[model samples]
Target chain A: MSAALHRIDTLAPRAEASGTHIAIAGLTKTYKTRGGSVPSLKPIDLNISKGEFVAIVGPSGCGKSTLLKLVAGLLPATTGTITIGGVKVTQPPDGVGMVFQSPVLLPWRTVRDNVLLQVEMRGRPVAAYREAAARLLHTAGLDGFEERFPWELSGGMQQRAAICRALVHDPEVLLMDEPFGALDAMTREKMNAELQRIWYETRKTVLLITHSIPEAVFLADRVVVMSSRPGSIEAVYDIDLPRPRDLSVMGEGRFVRYTQEIRKHFFAQGDLDH
Target chain B: MTDTLLVQSTRANVLSKLMSMDAIRPLILVAVILVGWDLAVRLLRIPPYLIPAPTLVIEQVIAQWPMLLRETMPTLTATLGGFALSALVGIPLAMLIASSKTVESYLYPLLVFSQSVPKIAVAPLFVVWFGFGVLPKIISAFLLGVFPVVVSTVLAFKSVDKEMIDLARSMRAGGLRTFIRIRLPHALPGIFSGLKVAITLAVVGAVVGEFVGSNSGIGYVLQVANGNFDLPLMFAALFVLSMMGVILFMALDAIEHFLIPWHASRRPDPNSGT
Candidate 1:
């Protein structure tokens, strides 16, 4: 087999092939405004298997983030349905964790308390999850800063706290919309490594939406490419790169080739799309 | 070296405390204004009744301290009572309006309409309904103050990022849980700003209520001073009333500081974190 498979049908066999975790069938979105209804997403179909990491890459205004919101059940689809963990998702489903581009942590809360917010919001006993919150913060390299406020930490640290908040409830599905998009280049690369380590330990099903081609190639088991404006899936590439990936892996030939392959789509469309 | 360090640090501390922009700038401006007013009144030979010198006002405060103290108590009670009432009721009302379309549609317009009707006009109505007791003054204060708290709180609750609410929903947090954990805390800074405005307005409301009808309070003292044509006493009452307004505003500011030190407005202290 070639290093990356572009065909949707010719994909390799996997543990989750028999059972799709997050199934999106003909999902679409149209926003209503005073002017008229504007199409945001064309009918899109994709399947993310349990414990698999998938990253959707597209140019700005492509609605890749919309797709993630749809799967997370934060938004109602214009057409079709989404299923997560064998249940139809009408409202925001349980056992799902989401992180946005901004940290979105409460300013009044300490880092530890912000993480425990997930547990507290779920009506769970906060005392029980204290250790879990502490461990998650520790893993995120924020052990000593648990009592600190979100503003006291750097941008990367705040996002780390937000990630920990997402996982504190022990949600099986982790949906991220450009989680490290706000960080500087160096910090983003480090966060990518940190995310990989966290994912390695937890093995949660993750659907990350991003514009960076290399970020998509580096983190995902499969990279789904999206079109601009009324976005639809353009191509899917299976990443055959070795896991337990690090910052150094980004420099490898395989990783560079995958990113270049994805970048080719935007270049073909227009330079302005990137 | 130690002695020099101590001296340098002490000088720095004094300079910062005396010259800092936070509180000292405003204090300096007030001092300038008072001195300029004193000079202008003496130079121009402005009559005491038109604008008494600051010195005469200070002397009036000292001479009639007992009477002023007696009147101040009632106004303070009414202001605090009305402010507390508005906060207790207004926050929940804001949450209701934010969460429900039905409440927003019916109640929001009515609230806006209520604001359009002047509080001075409503003060007489409150006095007529409740008689000349402190209840009328409190109701007047509540009428003037509640709108800001509700409006600010509503805007604050609505301004919370849609993603934050989604994150809560995905965690299986119900409506109340989403509000308590996410919405309420996020809305605090806005609510506090509204409270600060409301507190000052509450003082004005109490005075207005007394102007319309009242036996006690600083407003009554002003009315008596007006009848007597004792300009210094009038200036003293005005001075005391303004001081009370500042004190109430500062009280809310202090509360805001204690509650949300993590907020950007409260984090200007450079030596806060290590």
Candidate 2:
């Protein structure tokens, strides 16, 4: 465990020296309505290195989701810019996959076909990705159920299929907005383990947004907390946790301390979410 | 062993009896209604011209079977033609309305107003414009049917989860790709339900067109039967019309079953599978 912690200690400087995968420079977002302009995010800056996993946790309405949307290029930044893989992201970049809170699987599609939807929408030849989709579903423990529809699966299984869908295109970065928020506590833990395994194997840069302090600390290499509305990064903490951490690690002293530390922000804010 | 077998046999007997009752309940209700009508006519000595007995209606169905069958063709043709035309025009119009706010603002109010104008009152104008051929009846059907398709499809398109589109955008799926791959399929269930309502109205519209001018079809037959005081024949024609409406609705329902089998409404009960 100490050896793993030492590796994480070495990670930050090396990543900075090499160059960051995602760079946000003074990014802000404002939504215009008849009522007037409402600021969602303040001018925020963060750098995520290649193959790093970062999680952001904040109170409800804090605009952590808005930050993810800006990074995903689903919404334009009001001022400043976001760069991914050394290119300015004007629209959705070519190599990012996203998962929302709901599974959002096409009801008409079989589990495997839903995963292949990413490839199909991108104008890729679907036949070429068939094996890859099957392999990804297998990794999510959805083997032999490829022909099943979304309604046939439990909520947890549906979310797993969604995760598989996000990975099917072999993206360079994965963005998740409370992907497991709808799941039960027990199922959520299992999914966290599954996600960590997937991330460990793929080594893609990931940014996860969640309300659960334990979830954010359990999965992310660095945990960034944001303040309430018109959100800006409040603090950033290097997890200093071991790689390939299991669910039991959540009970460990370091993990509990991290969760406690993150939970303090939400408690102070008196948000309704908790 | 004998006691257990005896209990099992009795349980099976009760189950089978209950199953048969469920299957034949609707037929039993129909039988009671028909019997009551026949008895009322005979006991009151009512004239057949005023109200035909159920037996007389049955006799008319048997005696004029060939003529009824032939006249059914034209009415069927008009209904089918109008339904097809409604779908063809309405779907594209719905897509236009869904895609652009300007188009929606211009078209939606007009469409709603058109629905408020009764098809029966407007159908005579169609007969004058298109002549007494099947075309006028088809146009009448189209008028009645088109409204539901537009309204339902628009709702479906509007109701599509914004997050799903965000997911598509994050994948760099183009506008057309997102519409065809995501929005279109997602709207299909609501579109189909609209089509079902349109079909029922189309039947009424076609009959109204025949009432206005046509010399063929079941509508024409109904008019001729009324002139001659053929109450039994009128009832038979009404039966055929009701049956046609039911069959058309069921056919659309079956298509929905095949088209979107994974939809929540279509899927068999989770426990029913066992």
Candidate 3:
């Protein structure tokens, strides 16, 4: 426990030295409905540095996803600015990829075509990205099944293709919204390790919103715990786990300490399962 | 070695099941119905003018094949022409309705209102305006067939997973790109469903037009046969019409299967052990 505390203490200085890649200042979101305006997120400040893996974990309806969407520029911030790589994001920022909870693949497209969807969407010549797509699919362990359709693949494989699609364009940042939430526990654990390896290799700055405490600890360098409804940052715990994390790391002392520390925040609020 | 054997046996099991009696059940039921009808008509000694036996209908079809074939051309032409027109017009209209709230609010109700008015009732009006020609038949078919395409397409576009749209936006996909790559492909199964219904309706619409005013088509032939007391010929024409509907429907089904084999509906049943 003391060692875990010491690791958390060291994260701050290292993060400052690396320099910020994504800066969120006074960001908030209020959804205007017919009845009245409902505040989803309170004004919040957070900085994620280049190649940093940050996971935002909170109770359901805490607006953790709202924060991610604001950064992705899918939704406008009610008040404040989000600058990524020194530019303000008014519309969706370029060079950003996202994976949703469901695979959401095009049923008519094969696995290879689905991965190249990013290139096609950008109006870039898909022919040029063929090699890159193949490599990414290979990395995802989906090389032999490029011609297969989404329904032919299992849920885990489909999600892997979604990840490959996101990365095919070599995005600067990858935002995920509870990507493995639908998977069984064993598959989710496997995906966490696969994601960590991918992150290590690609080194894209990532912000993942998740409900699972262990998942956040397993994959993220820092876990940002948020308060329930009208969410605001409660605490940010630096995982401080070693690089290239595997499932075995979950059994380590620091890993359990990190997960427990984050879980305690939700346990206090009486809504932790979600 | 055991794993490969297990997989091979599973494949064989699925193949055998597919080729089993279940595959031919529909054919057997059809044969039974026809045989029953023939036997009942012969035993009761029903007058051919009132209700021709299946054998007499087949004899009439064989004897008048040339005339029947000639009349079938116009009906086929009108059905195909109007269905094509509906697809061309309805798809864009649906896209317009789905993309803009103003268009949807104004036009959607108007479309629903138009759909409520019995299309058969409107067939006479089309003949009065366009005259007793193929144009009126085509117009009537277009009117009847277009509603399903528009409604189903609108629903399809609306029902696209919101998360998938967010993924596209986060990747900096423009509105056009999003529609082409994400919205269009994602809405295919729904669109094809609409197309199937519309194609069948197109056949009905053509027949309705002929019933109101036409000298060609199977409907006109049926009217002529009835006036001359040639009940078997009338039944043969009716048979041709039903066959046309089935052929067009099966064609659409084949296209849907080929295009979206990845869809849940097209996937092999899991319990079949494939």
On residues A33-144, what C-alpha lDDT tens digit does candidate 2 reach at each position? 9999999998888889999999999988999998998898888899999999999988888899899989999888889999999999899999999999999999999998
Interface CA root-mean-square deviation for model 2: 1.1
List the candidates ranked by TM-score, beginning with the highest: 2, 3, 1
TM-score of each: 0.89, 0.92, 0.91
The clash count of every prediction, one per candidate, is 0, 0, 0
Residue-level lDDT tens digits of model 3 in A56-150? 99998999988888888889889989999999999988888888889988878899999998888877899999999999999999979999988
Show pairs that collide, candidate 1. Answer: none
Tens-digit lDDT track for model 3 on B95-163? 899989999999999999998999888888988899998999998899999999999999999998887
Candidate scoring better on DockQ of 1 and 3: 1
Clashing pairs in 3: none
DockQ of 2: 0.79
Candidate 1, which segments miss by more than 4 Å at Cα?
A1-19, A30-43, B1-17, B21-31, B118-129, B270-274
Q: List TM-scores of chain B, every candidate.
A: 0.91, 0.89, 0.89
Task: Give lDDT per model, in order.
Answer: 0.87, 0.88, 0.88
lDDT of candidate model 2 versus the reference: 0.88
DockQ of 1: 0.70
Q: lDDT for model 3, on a 0 to 1 scale? A: 0.88
TM-scores of chain A across candidates: 0.95, 0.94, 0.96
